[model samples]
Target chain A: MPKVTRYDAPRVIDSGSIWILVAAPTIWAVHFLLSYWVAAVYCAKSGSGWLGGLTDPRWIIVGLGGLSIAAIVWLGMIAVRRYGGVFVVLEEITDSSEQGRERFIGHVALLLCALSAVAIVFTVIPGLVFDRC
Target chain B: MRRGTSILFGVLFLTALGGCDGRHNWMAGAGEEAAAIGDLFLILMVGAAVIWSLVVGAAVYAHRRRAHPGLEREARLFVIWGGVVFPVLLIGALLVWGLFLLKGITADEGDLTVRVDGERWWWRVTYETPTGDVVTANEIRLPQGRTALFRLTADDVIHAFWVPALGGKMDMVPGRETTLALTPKKLGNWGGLCAEFCGGAHALMRFDAVVMAPDAFETWLAREAETAQVAADDPGFQVFLDEGCGACHTIRGTQAAGPVGPDLTHLAGREKLGAGLYEMTPEHMARWITDTHAMKPDIDMPPYPHLSGPRLDTLVDFLMRLE
Candidate 1:
């Protein structure tokens, strides 16, 4: 949004849809479901945990959590660069331009990434908490 | 305080203390695991109290302060420290402690092994000895100070075997076997129960966990191993055999060898009948024979209404002599 003094000024901007808002939490939601479901189904099939050298649900959940956190971090970097994702201060953008809207979206997405990362950690904690199902 | 009021207070205090002796009291600390669990519960309670006090104190201190601009940074630090860092550290520590506790309690080895199979409304118990498996029912008698490992499973449905005073509960899955270890420190009868609701008689399904002296337990096990001594010409034994009771019940050392129900070889020896629902006595036995559902609703055993008067008495006498 630099000063356009001439009529023939060139500009390029992101034309992505609003789906970016849900992308971060979607990872968290999928992780949450898969974590509990995997644990439950495995425990049901194998009975009590601590099976001798078998598939451990704890490590599986940990790996899933690590992947989720990594994905959130990548999204977070994008959000911070575009929207100034300081996280502590949330100032409203009143500009109705496309850039302003994109910035707002990016800011919201950044906050969501943080929230989702925290939520994913919470989900992973239960995986560590239980010794057996 | 007035004398009457003091007396009332004393009575209430004594009554509260009396609640500690109940068979299913997890706080009784009768077993090694229960004692450990009790200690964990105490630690958790104390930790929670301490955390609550600290948080409240912080909140009060913050509330009483003046609203200066300089206080904003301090307030943010307070929120982050008290709200975020403190809880994460405390809960993480507790979780680690609990995981270790769980590891310590869930043992893989024991001095003796007892296999318990959960039936619809009863328990079929078998003690694994070097000679062979000594089958029994309803009542589980373990030697005090020795760890008794229980291999538990269910016949048709899922049931949770919980002797609260002894240790943590484990589920009895139909196709899968779960193991639990109980090392009773005290010689007493701790109540065991079916914590999971399986069917109509789920509430009635229970067992007597009797922890005895080591020598006494050995003697009891020896006596229990022997088959019931059934005389050839006993009229009561004749009534038991004639009434088809042998089809569903087993009296070892005799022709009545049925594996469908609880073993009745030492039925009278058990303190409780109908799976710990009633006292093991002649009156209860007679009633149980005539109307099985009256003692425990929705049991698999059918009532014998026609076999009344002398016939029922003879059968009851034969069963009572099983001790």
Candidate 2:
């Protein structure tokens, strides 16, 4: 029999970790929309009203945001309808076998570490290269 | 309740941090306000990032050490907090910031004016000088300390006007007019290129934006506006007019009324010839007159294959002396 960590709402909610992935698409969408608005203003001001024909970034943001939210919501709905069994099976298997849990945690940690490294490069490298110019 | 709210707030804060660009300088010129607006939106993104990191950090902490039975109940609260409250707040703030930026950019009363037209593979820059003279050329020049208003349009396909140091890009679409504004504060030449891929030689369609002091620009304007006067009896000068070379080019004075190509009224005074391919030297002028296609391949200007030997030398001499 698989072990269940009770049906405590607080424990389940506090233990769930989806914010990082969620934030990626959300932040990018906002950035895209903002860029679109900025570029649109320039185009409109350019006195060449024909720029209105090009595809604006706002539409992309909306489409991406809608898709991401829908996917997350759908996943959450499936997880709930399956009565915690959706993740319980995977977690129980990993927890019972130390090597399995280590492997899973190690994979996630490595991915996060790589992402953090990339973010730092993107954030800091431009300043170093363009500061004098 | 507290943990749930903290997670939501954490996520927003993380977003705000991620969107920051440390190299952002102050918005200085005409189209600079748009950058300022972009900065505000970035602030919102940073806020979101901060919130995300904090929320995820707390969640991980809770997962590792909090073995309490009520965790699932807490998860419901956290979800509601993030899924509903956080998005509502985040989007509301974004909307407000976006509106503010939009207003700043759209405020009327531009200080300068310009007209940019994109052809098949080149840019046509027209500056309407204060003295009622409209100077048209491939390169863009601006007098420092003055706002340059740009009216962008395309003669063929779409092309984007971009000068990274000055401002963001605006597209030039066919059959329509788009307006952009820029005020080049510094006194130096800037590189400008077409951001859109138009056709063959698109990469070669480059232009230099010469930003000069106000006095220097005025002096240049005075010289540019002067009539090109050839001494009445110069044989080589007559050859220039008679060879039909004047038919496709313009000289401020004399009978060269052609507007099919670049204005050569003050071509001798420009820093480069053949659309920035060669230097402004007498030898380069002769070579260009002898074989323009060899220097700038695919140029619209036809090569003077017939003007060779003495004819080429005399024509180069006459053109070089036009200044």
Candidate 3:
């Protein structure tokens, strides 16, 4: 019988863990579409009112955006702790080693997290400025 | 080859310059909102031009110059500073500024409300006053320096209401009402049209946005509210009824209570007829009645080809007298 190895390439990096790389951008896209649709529907149904009034649609958008940012931050933490992602420096992981591929994914995920956070902030701007429809 | 290219560019530039004389020019800055937007556009255009020149210049310099292996850190720094940092800062600033301008232009309410219903190829305008609603068609008159809130809605299909000299376009969707506010600062007949293509004769769908003094506007609105004063047994009135013109047109204080077409109570008082397609003249009116398709193809109004000679003349005379 052959002896079992201590590391077996981490089971091809697991399909489920790949989602961590794209979680931030996916959350951003969802938040953007949801915010726009909600505002349009609400404006069409009910006319313009005072800011922070009863019929204001900004509250829902802000709430969802906050929750999405929190989730992305959690994913970023996982990437840093387990996948060896560095915040300041981008790692060159072009080698064929399994550890290199994992670190590459983590680095890309970290960058995407920052980009998605910026996009989420941008998405919330229209609500902050426009008090009415 | 370079000389030929230069000549071609010159011709193109001249053509573009000539095209600026169009009646629907938004850069005229005839209204407060339009002027605000125009100023913002000019600033953005200058900024964009500067940025584009810098980027292209840098690209050309990089491509032509000899590369050194020792300058890797310099190149990376340049990419970070020029490509990433500059673009982020510029775009972020622009976004905030644009949002601020948008907030400034948009108003919750105005001094007066004018409900404009977008039809397939025409506008059904109604002025809501403290007394009552004054119904009109194809023309909008406002007082200079006073804001007018336009409550826009479409009956059949989607259309966009645009008075370029006045302000930006607003979509008129069916089953929903969209509002836009305009404060005209100039006294002129600015062209208004349906920006969104609906169906046939969409291009012919136009209106005259006339800005006047406050007193003049008040007088005109009051006069427009009054009913037409015509003899009951007039030959022209008989011809109008016989030709079924009353079925689709309304003449105030008369039995002609049709809701399909425009109200003809103040037809002669209008600056243009056929929805701003022609100057309001008796000759054009006669041609419009007989050769409706020739004037505006695929219009809802049928041509009165059979009614010629005295009958056509009488009908035209009656419509002309509807001031």
Candidate 4:
């Protein structure tokens, strides 16, 4: 039986998992277009819509893009803190199945946090702070 | 299992980061302004790194001891210090430091005046010489240990004239003159670069400040003032005139009256060609004239890509003999 330690325990950490953490916020940040598309679709489908007319689509996109950028940044920071710690733990933990699971969970959490931090910080915050382009 | 591979990757990343330091290394006596600014920037970065390392080390030690494992004390302290005191003090200090540096550049000097105009990719340096000759463009030959008052302006967009060894940067705004003064302390070929990003060829916008001894500078100036005597009334001279080089360039003694390009009165004497791309030589001059864009992409100087062979040689030879 392998010794249970945080470092070498369940090593499910790979670049793919890391990228999922990276891509979530990136997709969400750019999702403003979907909102506009939905709004337009609703107007066309139901023969109802004055909201899109009053507000320029340009402003709407810019606002959404800014928010997404902020969210991405926030997610990135969380990811950095979490991922940075997991790598540190890998050196110290004794390898055991149970410990491996814990380490794997921690890695996932860190990846999620980094993604969230980056998304929010880069996308959402800037949207709130600055005027819409 | 691939421990060595991970370590190698880490090492490679570190090496790449190390290379990001600007090419202006202080290993040897290079540009004066670059040396000063680079040394200061390095010192500040190293100091910050040391401080951060110490703080991290302390935090690690505290964490290992399980001192406030729940981080109650740290949380409260972070809210108080991180949220308020740290930002206020840090930002205040930075503001004060910036103002102090600004004062040094803007010190009152109402005597000396030299207009330095920034174009798309080169410095249009016009010096109001004592002999009333407003020497302009490319090479800036100044007597060592003399204060120069530069009125910096741009013909197009904003650009910065900075010689880190001599003094600070002055923004050259279109339709406005920014002022900066410097007294060169050493006598060597000092480098000056556009600190501002202008366009595609901004990186290549480099010039040299040749700080010669007072007597040597005088001799060079006197030699420059003489009308350029072409070594021969060669066909190359006719090629130069026929090529419409005269329309946009000025050769002091010849029919070349073009100010749209750099003054080529004393072309042979200059050390660098095409704004520091290549060393000034007969061969390089020909190569540059024949195909300027190939050597430096997006330079304002249009390439005569069509001209080649003897036509190129004669034109290059004629320009090189401007001494």
| Per-candidate RMSD, Å | 5.9, 15.0, 3.8, 15.2
| Tens digit per residue, CA lDDT, model 2, B1-323 | 99999999999999877654221222323235445644775786898799889989988998899477657666666776776557755665566556555443433335556687887556666666577665556667778767677788898789887665566467889977766666666666565677888777677666666778878987776776677778767677777787787887877667778867777766766666765445678789877776877777666777777777777677777777765
Q: Model 3 over residues A1-133: C-alpha lDDT tens digits? A: 7666876545433432687777789999999999888787777656454433575677777887898899889878878877877664422457677777777778888889988988998898888787666
Task: Write down the RMSD of candidate 3 (Cα, Å).
Answer: 3.8
Candidate 3 lDDT tens digits, B1-323: 99999999999999998866555888888899888889889999999899899989999998999988787777777887788778878888889988887665556589899999998788999999999999999999999999999999999999999999989688999987778889999899999999999999899999999999999999999999999998999899899999999999999977888899888999999999988789999999999999999998887899989989999999999999999
Worst 10 residues of 3 chain B by lDDT: B99-108
- Candidate 2 chain B lowest-lDDT run of ten: B21-30
Q: Give lDDT: candidate 2, residue B247.
A: 86
**Candidates, DockQ:** 0.20, 0.02, 0.45, 0.02
Candidate 3 ranges beyond 4 A from true positions: A1-16, A44-55, A89-96
Error of 1 at A119 (Å): 4.8
lDDT by candidate, in order shown? 0.85, 0.60, 0.86, 0.65
Candidate 4 docking band? incorrect
- The per-residue C-alpha lDDT of model 1 at residue B69 equals 76
Ranking by TM-score: 3, 1, 4, 2
Of 2 and 4, the candidate ranking higher by DockQ: 2
Task: Compute the lDDT of residue A46 as modeled in candidate 4.
Answer: 40
Tens digits of per-residue lDDT for model 1, B1-323: 69999999999999998887799899989999999889989998998899889889867986997778766777677776777777767776777777667765566679999999999989999999999999999999999999998889899999999999999788999987788888999889999999999999899899999999999999999999999998987889898888888898899988888889889999999999999888999999999988888888988788988888888888888889999
Alpha carbon deviation, residue B308, candidate 4 (Å): 5.1
Clashing pairs in 3: none
In angstroms, how far off is B268's CA in candidate 4?
Answer: 1.6
